[model samples]
Target: MDHVDRTEIRPCRAADLPLLDRHLPTPGAPTRHADRFARQEAGTGTYLLAWRDGVPVGHGQVRWDGCAAPGVRAAVGECPEFNGLDVRAELRGQGIGTALIHAAEELTRERGGTALGLGVGHDNPRAAALYRRLGYGPVVAYTDRWSWTDPDGRTHEEADPCTFLVRDLTTPDA
Candidate 1:
């Protein structure tokens, strides 16, 4: 189990908040991750970071909730055992997204999670391809709230902006 150089993924700490937020959903907006980091710090969730030469280049967060997306009912946020991977946009490719996801899955499995989950913008076909290539599969069709203060922090909780995904972390074989 040897990983590559130039970028290493690790568990996130309080001191890494600023670094994590840098590649997070929003630019120059710590408020975007305010709610998420608070819970992770409070022991309700976990955040993973991807670093290059001690510099934070990517980040992902895992939570014990379901359906974080918006406009979906009944199944959105239903299960409490699943985890989510909220990564940064700046490092979407270059293996950063996949590395961060693998790191988060490790942390989630260590935390007793059997299933891994995440949501991506419906229009982001590139992201969809990336996730699919990394072993993630779509379970349900859903959306996220687009606002001025969400992870991307624009200020509009628009409806159905993304798709829901859940991957089996146990079966590493496809």
Candidate 2:
């Protein structure tokens, strides 16, 4: 038997929130991890967190309804969108992101999504490259819409230039 080393990717739970917040903390803004976990607890969507030796290293979310990318919701209509993907800065290049993406794809497929969609910021070429390497192709160019609250509770909005990508999960190659 060939044994392979793999990071554990699992759904976020209430107890995981603090650790997730510590790992993915936004100093001046409200903790994004907590918000995602809250959404998970509320059943808004499924949020996945990656663990390595009991340490939180990566996170991603799957929204079955729509995506934040301006045209993605309209274009991919009804497909699950992988969102908020991030890995610890120190863990980059360790295949953590890839593992998280694969986990999300599997979950999407299990949920009956025939396609998976995502958006990568124009400024994040490395992530875009990884997405391309993993078989995601550009579907449309649009502004990614999102908002976050500052630590002081002030809400800040953002619209970033991004490219929406999608992969057909129905294909064996995907």
Candidate 3:
């Protein structure tokens, strides 16, 4: 593992959106990742960033949802406890994303959350492996298929499946 000797955490702001959006998947499908971020910036939820030096390196966000733990009425303003963490392409795998995600999870727990969740395409084994290593586990699996051709004239889709891996906040390692 590479050494990340220095880091800082701050709130996500409008200035970071363009950089963050570039790292996100296309919006062909519906997801609250982008929209919820907008809301967070508008004082709806908590949004934070993890920076290296003076440059933006990673981010974490928290938003409310109607899907809390079982049997309870998940309120709109309740913390859903997920994040769209993006580590800059140049700085990935150096533990930036991991630190950002852990920061979000910690904040969610401080806010009384019992669980935290995030989605990843099943085809992206690299991301899945990272999440798993961080102690998140599969909670929901579903399909989000799409296709795109490359400059090499090849195409692929999300034929495999996608899933949301959740780590319970009340449990250890959360």
Candidate 4:
């Protein structure tokens, strides 16, 4: 994929939901953008979107509440968690995902957070390697679990083993 020369990272807004739905639709549960935006409005977290040429290219969620996994919570006490980072399949490897991560880190620092945490599924070595390269270190291993409803109203659960990584924001390259 060609590198995006000028990707803009910003907080998601209600008006952007339509564009997101068209460009980055979450098929199973498509109201995600609205929900995350609502959470942002409530001061819970920020859902960031990466755009190139006015097209949504990537996104991520910075959870002020930290990881839901008990082990991660216990090990990375009070740390903000960066979750659900996704880049358009055709535009990956061009720094879009990295920019989204950097944006999330900046948001954390702006909120007076000293560190940030994220989970990489055990099966996803590529993502883990990216985090390591960006200064995150594995803190603990835990079951990454969550559930979501489909558009048809069927709920699904997931429980995957993963390693939670934390980065010290005291230093940008740490």
Q: Tens digit of lDDT per residue, candidate 4, span 1-174?
A: 456558989999888999999999997777788888888999889999999999999999999989878888788876999998999998878889888999899989888999999999999888988999999999999998777898788999979999999999998453
What is residue 84's positional error in candidate 4, in angstroms?
0.7
Query: Which pairs clash (backbone N, Cα, C closer than 3 Å) in model 1?
Result: 66-77, 67-77, 146-156, 147-155, 147-156, 148-154, 148-155, 148-156
Strongest candidate by lDDT: 4
RMSD of 2: 2.4
Report, for every candidate in turn, its global Cα lDDT versus the true structure. Answer: 0.63, 0.81, 0.64, 0.89
What digit string (tens of lDDT, one per residue) describes model 1 on residues 42-147? Answer: 8766666677767776666676654555433355444332233444455555677777777777776776777777777788788789778877777677556544
Write model 3 residue lDDT over 20-127, tens digit each, in one string. Answer: 555544354233345656778676577777766566677766655623333222222243655456666777788877777777778777777777777677677888
What lDDT would candidate 4 get against the real structure? 0.89
- Minimal lDDT window, size 10, model 2: 1-10
Off by over 4 Å in 2: 1-6
The Cα error of candidate 1 at residue 145, in Å, is 0.9
What is the per-residue lDDT of model 2 for residues 73-173, given as tens digits with 9 covering 90 to 100?
67777678888898889879888888888888898889787888889999999999999998999988888777777767888898889988998888864
lDDT of 1: 0.63
Sort the candidates on TM-score, descending order. Answer: 4, 2, 1, 3
Q: Candidate 3: where are CA atoms >4 Å away? A: 1-3, 14-37, 66-81, 144-160
Q: Is candidate 2 or candidate 3 better by lDDT?
A: 2
